[model samples]
Target: MPMRRLRPRPALPSRRKAAATVVAAALVGGAFVGILSLTGTPHAPSARAAEGTGAGEHVRAKALPADAHGKSGKPGRPVRGVRPPVSVVQIVAHPDDDLFFMNPDVSQSLHSGNPLTGVYLTAGESDGVNARPRDAKAAAPDKAGYAEARQNGIRAAYAEMATGSRTSPWDRSAIPTKGGGWAELDTLRARPQIRLVWLQLREAGSVNGDRPYSLHGLWNGRIGVLASQRAAGTPVPTDFAYTKEQVVATLTGILERFRPTFVRMQDPSPGTYPKTGRFRDHQDHLYGARFVQSALARYAELPGHPHVGVQNYLGYPTSVLPHTLDPETADAKLRTVKTYAWLDGVHDCGTDAGCGDLKVAARPGGRGWTQTVRYARGTSTSWVQRDRDGGLHAFSVLDGRLAAWRKPADAVAWRGPELLPGGGLDSGVTSVTLPDGRIAVFGTRTTLGDSATDYRREVVTTVQDEPGGGFGPWLSLGTPEPDDASGTSDISAPAVTVAPDGLATVVLRDSRHRLTAREQRTDGDWDPWRPLGGTDVYGDPVAATDAEGRGYVFASTPKTVLAWAAQSPGEPLAGPAATGLPPTTLALSASAAPDGEGVRLWFRKPASGDLRSADFSGTGPVSPVTELPGTGVAGYGPVSGGDGLVAVRSRTGFLATAPHGRSGSRPVWTLEKFLFSGAPDAGTDGVAAIGLDARLHWTPAGR
Candidate 1:
């Protein structure tokens, strides 16, 4: 989230980073989504006024059918009681951080049905008065009162987004944190699913300033105990202090209680001006996100905890990149920001954080920069999948829609670029082969409402009309957490495969970031959505079928990999059972293990991003993870074939390949001149990726 600049304060001496582990970066985008539903879940269905009644009024969702043009248009059945299962916890340094950095997503998730929890690390006691300087000259600053008012404004905005009313009453209470201090927690009265937690700690007075007693000081070893800047209306008896370890422990405790599938915070790696050497984001934002990252590691290691994904947003500098959000999505984001600012001259919150930031409320649409969002380190793996006939079928999101291409076993060059129909699809899609040889293209569709803010992301698929021809119209498999579209960014790209009975099974990360699956029956109808029981899964899922035709789906957490296997065709999937492997990049590749009873998983190790592998044979234990000895390998692969063909990137970002298959083998990876993004498709034909120039580049395995 961007830091709202306060009045010109004295510039304090700049201190260097506190620790070497701090991921000081401009962008490190890893795909994570939060599901929103039609109810109080992150995605609210309508703008119904909050009556403060415990029973929330439901907004019926509109169903869009295909028009004559084969695109979304005609009205189908409206999905009611469609509650999404995902939850989101947003950690920011101040009140407006989410608005400035993570909206559109925030608005979308809330509209979809993912429950939300926002944690504000500081009280944001900026100059303390709710009024402007010109009007507050005669009044003393009320830090406590001002903080309360700001929180009230936040409650109003959150209520409106989740329940369509700013006056949604909140049950506020004090909760004890592991840090040995009391933090304020608020729950929505009508929609008990939404929550807010306030740490109410002191804010730094200046940008790039170092304090011996603030979050920065604690992070850097300059402070032993930091005192609280309690919100006056909070239900704590006495003010308390927190040590550095205590603070980390306390955030960790909050995470344990929430068990959030998705976690978001401001940029942890906020570098400084190149020439001036000044920090980019606020000291609190950088340090606060770092603490959260540290807490996440601890949380992930806990025995019995669910898998959780983390998304670190870009700070101020994102403005310079190309506008990533659609115009409608961007507009919806600003509207929410305006709501938080209370820009419509509304005073519904009644308490002091003084409705909202009047300064920003007066100018809700800040410079065009606020409309843009970008992520760092996005490695887009290819969507190329090989079918039984040895023909290649590939899918990509072209011009905001799903596009298809084919290469026949008897043909030389790839076939026509057949554009399939699906709207609001993310940048990529996945495809799988059926037992009959026809290919099925699967994707997460984004259905947009009249207002961009109202959106939905659902699992969708379409089969090839003829063996090597264009695909049929899109089929809506529907989301388990069918939301009104407050948000659905948490949904992952699909990992699909076919069962022995010719049934098509598609697996993907649900709105809740869990592994979920749906299968097409003999009648060509899809089964209802259900969880495969894995957590913290990210990006595109990877699936492989053993010799028995039992399908194995693998999902990568920030630190570990989990697999769910199919018992039989037309039967429920089981076993998100742990693979007992160490952490990997959110990306991974899986192929049937040579033993025919298990699967081989390939991924890059964290910290070094070195390509590594372990064999899972559905036996007693997985083999010890062995490093695929190589230097300068920055990412994992589009791993394919029983004889694995791996893709790797150099430390300098050039892409290349390495072979790893035979037992006890240590093949070396050499850097090539090709500059590629996404995974390289490796098969009997070759490896392919979108080059730096944005064109698909193909390299034969012989090279």
Candidate 2:
């Protein structure tokens, strides 16, 4: 049945008339011509989405997000020199999952000096032997021995990332999680802050674990006690079995301990029970991630949990796609994987779990994953923030430097490739207009050492003292993981909300994936970084101001959307209670609800790549989630809004804009070839995209 939503609560009277006129004229040819007509400017063909395109090709509103010509509007090949600010904690099914599916990203994080922690769910004892194929004297299958070897390989690779030596010693210790399980923690002796936690659970051993001996069994209620398979040569002698509930609690305990701001997980949506085809990940990878998802959900409900962000990687699935990583990045990723594969001679760590997986060693270049990296939800996470004037500014990281471009409030021509006063800023950026009109840019910036092993990432900021004025020097807002010996931490792009009185609160996901914040006091001083308390928030933070000038913050977890709002401006923030939204893609766009009664949220339904939205009036329950008109590969990105206009991009790389409430499933203005940085700033002059060609693509306001 064709779903009928309440026609997006009709626009205001005069604007409604303008829309009616547009519809009347547009009905003659199609919504395309009608929308273009509203702009009252000649439309040009779009070719710069991915690969450059020629002009004169007609772009239309009714078309899907991607161009039929194969211009997918993917973000320009990622700028190579910059580092990611995201502190990453990858929880995977085996020792090499990070190398295989989460490459480049894993390597990039380490190389950029971001604090990283890897959690392995199982021993990965496929044949249970830790021997290279070329070694004729290799031992027979011994799960414990093989697990130890894998751990050795992982440690070597991680140590190299931290201190430039594969054989760097580690301080191995057993830590008890809140869920009543003991985990092996290996902290690098050279870099004590970076560590690996091994749970050493038994593997399912097959795609379908019908025997009830696997994570699948535990998740499906087929098994209550999943036993631990301890790795060899470990000082901790005891082993234990966990009930289904205990497993989730165990994972949750780890989350609480690590408190990752961003969690990298294998895709958990396997689509069907008897998994088939591309959408399915390994059963363990799928279910193990499901366990993590379960943990995140449970953790989020805790009163004082940190906001955790999540990013899911397409495992095995990435092997078939075109390479997403640049050659340099991919090659760097391969080297790290090769280390885990023990491509270099193995270090004889005396134990049952041998040096590393020989199968991967024999083919260390890797089947598919080592050569590329793909985010299940698509990447281009940069945002473009705007202010009250018609003028708009776009910010991005170019060659590790924060770059800015501004379209003057009164003119259409964009100007400035102006570099902000910092070189180590993270790739994507977040900006907020202060109450005084100064634009403040917030991001987790990285300081690259002379070598890949020397790096430090922290949340920092720089703001324009006045609109269109020069920006002050990059300012230190500080990092969440300040005292970690590694000196690097995972923090999400900032979500800074400015109140009418000019009070601003900066929200971020700490290394633990917990939501933390720092607010500006009336004395012009900022508060210390502190947890505001929410969990499993695996995406960028978003916020909007209510009529009362109170700020409301929202974040998405694997299961649902959670929100926290200030009872009043400058008051301690409260209530990250559930907002009643369903599972959503990590990306979200939000604005003040048109009715002034609540806030409206725009996001993609996970995996569906369909636009979805919901509204919550502070007085009542959230409105039902409604699907918007978008079905594509990338899902949705950041959104920009102002002066009653809102703009967004579908995952399929389409550009869309509409009057505040009027953009539901059907947006009023769409340009199919409009691929851009996720952040779109809308103002009286028009809607604009920081083009893939590194130019500003602007369309005049429809009304």
Candidate 3:
């Protein structure tokens, strides 16, 4: 295809002006950022802005009566109900990374008609061979041509997703990056809301091999400035090199320009086998994600940008895990890949370099990528809690800090997602309510230091000093692994449960896939970390308390679920007994049974979205599993249950819910068509989720 004429660079808008315009548009439209109904309608903002404080202001918690039930008396500063418009910015290592790992999501966001931008860090010119080995007539190695072909494929795929046709034209232009380089920018003409940015940096030829000039080398300080590889027929006029600081600055520039409400990237710490010393994902994916992480840290420090929620997607490692998508969803995902791979081998795109990456034509799906989508972090379902006064409080990590949202028992609308004070908190936050009604929130925090080796992750928690009161300072709970190098900071999000005596126990799966925990003493001191005896454990562990006040914890392996239950109230947990269950999709949730018989464990069957549950009274054998009637909306993730209600992610990437105990009868699932981060949390009066727009959305009971 002939390259489109480059458009003149437009004057950039100031950050403050841009931010104000977004907020005004959203408020005038009566909708929160990034939220859309099933019919693509925007829901009205549920609450008016607080009178005195700004929307992002921090509200000081006031103390309530010791025995108060969910009442916070009078709100200090209500959370700002009006939020800025929502936009998404995704950064990946290569052209097809978003399609392989972040899709269904990418496609769904496009359907929502929100502003979405994808940024590619490198020119994926691998071996310069655009065809499979069997195609002898394929052209000789032309790195520039291969890169251009890949770009064409990506454009076609995204166009088909945004508009209805793959032939939709795009407006091509060049933009100056903060990293002191020029990047090619393509905007879909049919739907101006969608865009693609190409940095055109050099990619490592080998996936796992030692490439001294690659992103991995630069990240590890083995190289200075990595040179760029401009694609053939690109709009960029000249090539450039980027040092570590420059690369981060470039990404930070993109974030500032877009001011996205949600940011997506690959997993920085995909983990490695200690014995084999093999990384779980491609080196470029890992190192590139690290650069994005650093850029996000820098972006968070700058003012005027909207608060953003971060989601890290699992990359190549999803191949080894069981398929998370059903046939229908998987097939849809495969169709997009086929378009990107130019599987039909048609030259319809008019590109002499070939329409797409023909090398992927032989296996368009690429391992098991198209069949599954898994999150590397932020899968915790314990983020929502009911306080003593029967009010609801929901928590999520936004801009590397704890964001709290509350709904009073007497109020019709929710309030305050007012962010807490500190930062560096990672995704996947969990919480537990103490006997006295105080709630404690837990999460892992990433500490980035001067050197790459200084990167570290450790558990930290903050608790309300009294019911409905201000939270105390964050307390650090050191990691079980000795350091970041050994563990790659691959610890699971903390699963905590408060005992009847008011003590708390935090459980987590260590880097070696073993369960370890710490117990709180009467004097408010914590016990040293101790192993809980389990191997091959994967995913985050869950903790729950039964009617008898006993605490139960469960973690899943590829084959079965393992359990660790307290022998008595206020005591250490016992054996990691086998649950004798079948393989699961690695997502687990727990809640007390309605009958008060035992702690009920909820999970999905392997390769299917069917929900199943079994009651565990103690460490003894669990009750026979019971399958819930399918809502016909297949999805993979933890299911949150409370007050006889359950909330799950539906196949359409929306929140779906059904009441518990409708066995034999098909329950009507109330589906909400908004894409959200982390897991949905269910409470007595409502279901809550953190929307991609970085705001908390609550669905009242019976809605």
Best candidate (score: lDDT): 3
lDDT per residue as tens, model 1, 433-541: 5555566667666553433234455777787776555578888887766543222234566776566676767777764567777877779787776677766555567
Off by over 4 Å in 1: 1-382, 387-390, 410-412, 415-418, 484-489, 593-598, 617-621, 624-630, 635-644, 668-672
In model 1, where is the ten-residue run with the lowest total lDDT? Answer: 14-23
Best by TM-score: 3
What total of clashing residue pairs does each candidate reach?
A: 47, 34, 10
Off by over 4 Å in 3: 1-84, 136-139, 616-629
Clashes of 1: 47
User: Per-residue lDDT for 1-703 in model 2, tens only?
Assistant: 1211112222221111101111111111101110000121112324432222111111221111112221222222212222112245779999988878866455445654556789999878766756666762566777787778888888877877667878788889988866687889888776665879998889987765355788877776677788998988665569988877888888888877776645778765433212232223577987787677667666655544322345566676444334444345556678887888877664565544555676678878666676555454323222455555646676665334565656555643444445555565554666666656677777766553433233345778887777668788888887766532222244566876666667778887764557998988889789898898876556567665544455667776767767776654557566566655666656666654444333445565443334454543222222344444342222234454444666665333456666554333323444435334335666444565544333344555652
Q: Report every candidate's CA lDDT.
A: 0.56, 0.57, 0.74
How many clashes does the backbone of model 2 have? 34
Using all chains and alpha carbons, the TM-scores for the candidates as numbered come to: 0.47, 0.50, 0.87
Residue lDDT tens for model 3, 1-703: 1222112121111000000011111111111122100111223322321111212221112111121111222234433323335699999999999999998889889987889999999999888878876973666888999999999999999999888789899999999999999999999998998999999999988777889798988988999999999888799999899998999999999998888889999988787787976777888998899899999899888866667889999999788777788788889889999999998887877768888988888898999899888888888877877776767777888788887867676755456556788888888898777777788899999888887888888899999989888899999998898877665788898887667787889999888889999999999999999999889888888876544455667788878777776654577876576666677888887764434333345677666677666543322222344444444667777777655677888776777776664224344576665678889887556677777767666665664
